[model samples]
Target: MTKLALSDEILMKIDKPARYIGNELNSVVKEKDTVDIRFVMCFPDVYEIGMSHLGIQILYDMLNKREDVWCERVYSPWPDLHAILKEENIPLFSLESQQPVKDADFLGITIQYEMCYTNILQILDLSQIPIEAADRTENDPILIGGGPCTYNPEPIAEFFDLFYMGEGEISYDALLDLYKKMKQEGASRKDFLHEAAKIPGIYVPSLYEVSYKEDGTIAGFEPVYEDVPRTVTKQIVTDMTQAVYPEKPIVPFIKATQDRVVLEIQRGCIRGCRFCQAGMVYRPTREKDVERLKNLRTRC
Candidate 1:
């Protein structure tokens, strides 16, 4: 049995103790010694809200499919447990192994909305990581931000080590393989980040220098190194039918905001409403095959 980070006493005091426990059905758990990478996926909100997200579920299943990677999950503690952790000096832990998120190799946060911005800092602080990316040491988990908010990540760029632009399914495998190779070679964090910037869709904020005009408008933004690309293109999956989707999503103990199984039928939109950012960012709408979706529905 895995030892939970929180005590029985602490669990009893919290409203939904099951939120912190790790034995949810279909949740992935692997031996620490078996995997080269330990990635913690975070939603930066309460468990109920975080558990409802389809993107996180897909990534969790996708990453765990790799034998070299042991992907776990974490979510922002609710007010009651948040205060308890602060008072007791308990570190924020992942759901699968109930291990400190700080110990993971990567802490990938899904930045779905602007409202959850502050919660990102809370997650870092509770995990015992430096809130500022520059202040962090090599020992700290690599802070990665993804999701829709990353389209305009300038405001929160300083908080994250790197941002994964567009769909994760495209570039994540390459990124993880690079990290694994670099880790085996004993590459420094700085060296790894510099090389990681070269990967398509990866934006390492520290490598670029931004200058402001006298009127506070953007004057210039360019990479410090000549080798780095001037533009980081967004990655997209051309064929959604072959893309990985979670066949068996973990069922939360409590009722989540979206409790039913979710199936992503399509990406982008043909209508292309001007007001909608998703429709604009996710261009050239691609949809899954009807036959595949039917097969997936039966499996679910």
Candidate 2:
């Protein structure tokens, strides 16, 4: 059995203790020593809200499928526990093993909304990681931001080491493979990030230089190194049927905002609505096959 991060006394005091103690149904648990990479997926919100996000579920399921990777999860602690952690000086921990999130190789935060910007900092602070990406050393976890908000990540760009520009299904494997190879080679964090920038859909903020005009509107934006590509393209899965789908998602102990199983039947839209960010960013609509979805439904 995994040990709880919060003490019995602390758990007793908290409103929803189930949120912190995570041995939920279908949640992935693996031997830490066996994996080369320890990736922690975080949603910068309370457990219930974070648990409802389908993107985190998909990535959690997908990453854990790799024998070399042990992917765990963390969410922003509610105000009650948050205060206690601050007072006690306890590091934020992942749900699976109740291990400190800072110990992980990667800390991937899903940035869905502009409202959760401060919450991102909150996650970092609680994890005992440097709030600024530039302050972090090689010992620190590589901070990554993804989701819709990454399309315009300038506001929170300084906080994140890298941003995944599009659908995770497309480029994550390549990035992970590169990390493993680099780790074995005893490469520096900056060196690894330099190489990572070359990968499709990866945007390393530190690698580029952005200059503002006198009016503070626009100016020059280019890579510092000549080797780096001028443009970081957005990745998309050509075939939705071939993409990964979580057959068995984690069932939270407490009631989540989205309690029932969720199956993503389609991605992107054909309407091309000007107001809809999802329609604009997720171009060229793709859908999963009905039979495949039915099979997934049965598994769920």
The local distance difference test score of model 2 is 0.93
Q: After superposition, how far is residue 17 of candidate 1 from its true place, in Å?
A: 1.1
| Candidate 1, 1-300: lDDT as tens digits | 899889999999999898899788899989999999999999999999999999999999999999999999999998999999999999999999888999999999999999999999999989999999999998999999999999888889999999999899999999999999999999989999999999999999999998888987678889989988889999999999999999999988889998899888999999999999889988989999999999999998
Model 2 bad stretches (over 4 Å): none
Q: Score every model by TM-score.
A: 0.98, 0.98
What C-alpha lDDT does candidate 1 achieve relative to the native structure? 0.94
In order, candidate lDDTs are: 0.94, 0.93
What residue runs in model 1 are displaced by over 4 Å at the alpha carbon? Answer: none
| Ten-residue stretch with the least lDDT total in model 1 | 210-219
Candidate 2 similarity to native, TM-score: 0.98
